[model samples]
Target: MGLLVPVSVMAAPPSVGSVSISPDPAYTDTPLTATPSEDWYDEDGDPEGYVWRWQKYSTGISDWEDIADQTDNTLDSLYFIAGDQIKVICTPFDGVESGVDVEATITISNSLPTITGVTIAPDPASTASTLKATPQGWYDADGDLEGYVWRWQKYNTGILDWEDIADETDNTLDSSNFVLNDQIKVICTPFDGTDEGVPVEAVIVISVLDYSGSIDVKPGSDENPINLGSNGVIAVVIYTTDGFDATTVDVSTVKFGPSEAAPVHYAYEDVDEDGDTDLVLHFRTQEAGISAYDTSVTLTGETDSGTAFTGTDTIKIVPSKAKESVQGNEDAPGQNKEPGESATGKAIGKESAPGQNKEPGESATGKGKNK
Candidate 1:
């Protein structure tokens, strides 16, 4: 029968729903994956095979160019550069095309990260000063401003190498150990969890103030003791380092011996006349009798804008003795009598005793015994 030979017709081409892409926000020189939705179907209920094709939209040519072709349901190992556009097409067939061709397109937008304007505070630094670091004008495609990492480094004196400072992270640095003529620098870089951007750096040279000096007790030595009267005064002179200014020294820090002795008076002088001021401190002796006593002196403070200095010395104190006088005349030995004494060792006005003569020229006090 002619009615039994019915003809079988092919179905429409395959149709797919919206496409999905992993890592929607891509960065420079990175990978991206595109997946088709499960809503894809063919008019023939099922297709023998599925085809996936990828193409890149070229702005220069104002057209799309084929990039890859495969029979799988998904595509991978696709790298997109900055500002690149991608497109994917899917088709299903079972001896005949079914439904319409499914297509999806995505624009790849990626930019590189940048860091700039790394800075340090307090250009001239010291060991006692706190140095600060400041960075500016840094941004990335991810729009993360505070995602920057920091590190500090120091340059060896006279050496062409740099050393990384341990535990010196963030935007601050511990300049406590920095010495004169030391060179220091800081580096800042941007991090977006998966990648690191370019690095920016800044450097500064350090200058430290020195206040090294010594203290000296006058009229005293390591072996010899100082001689002072009952009420004597002690004199102390302090010598500072070549570049230190002694005039700004704080005299209150000068201590005499274990007991803190307040200086009776203090002055500055150019003892060596080298055009720099040196310190001089005067201290009144204690009521203790001077009999070879030990005196420890120390100077613990100096300078106003520089580092303070410390000096100490040990000294001895001795008492002064008066001279003894003899109660005798110039012509007599161990006696004070008038000139021309009698030979019998009696005064001229005294009466003669026993057989002794009482004459002024024949007295025992005379220049010589009577001939």
Candidate 2:
């Protein structure tokens, strides 16, 4: 015997028996925690500091990739997809040589789901108009889209906040309640047998049309242009029928004819004392040079939303007078005598001279007796 010497052999690697992965049939893009069985052991009974290496094999690339490596006995699953295979191995070292890798595998049976795109048929939707939410490009890891729910919401400007559409749960919205520059958002969520998944969201803007108010010409408005007196005050009453605040009417949009005029005096009050507020505006007709004999008094204005409103009334002007009067029936050279009887009961072509009385049917050319 050639000096028979007993040599010490290095212990074998630790066997990480079975890998228990919570949610084995995990959904794609969802996290799953993997825990190795406690039956793992090193032949030398020194498994401390054993290295755990996790690897993944993707069907898309047909290759194995090293995902993570640590001393811990657990693996945090991330970004796994259907037909993807994952494995964890433990290597134990006996101070000098490394042992074999004892491994276990877990295959992903499901994939991730997603809502790729969303749209509105008429993106800039109008108030009281139908708005339909069209969801496009959806993917279900499980290849099913039967259990999906949706909700719509609007950004409110009054309180400067978002308001949920309580009564709307369908994919199509009818008679949308939108204001100018309204931001609308929608959310879609997945549900599977009473289990709810994460939700996806999309946003769109609603362009509402501006509001236009109806107008009316107040009573006593002259069909003919009435002469403007020295004061030149022309009173106007605006009947606001729009949904906008009349008190906040845009002064720039308020115009008389083609001329612009600042409100000399304006108030939304009960001018007629009828207990109802009326928009009253005063314009200096003379100052605006709108005292033409015949002119159209065009009242034009707009709301804060830039909607146009207009009212027009025709009028005619005349010479200024303290009071209207009837023509006199006095006689004069080359002046035709009054065709009708005078107020004093004198017939036509007959008039009394000063301090004289004329008989009925007597010509004024004839000498009449003095009264």
Question: In terms of lDDT, which candidate is strongest?
Answer: 1
Question: What lDDT score goes with residue 340 in model 2?
Answer: 29
How many clashing residue pairs appear in each of the predictions shown?
16, 5
Q: Estimate TM-scores for all models.
A: 0.38, 0.35
Q: Which candidate number maximizes TM-score?
A: 1
User: What CA RMSD would you report for each candidate?
Assistant: 22.5, 18.8
Query: What's the lDDT for all of these models?
Result: 0.55, 0.53
Residues 126-195, candidate 1: write the lDDT tens digits.
Answer: 5445778877776765454456688888897557889888888888877564766678888888665545
TM-score of 1: 0.38
Q: Which sections of candidate 2 miss by over 4 Å?
A: 1-18, 21-25, 28-112, 191-197, 210-371
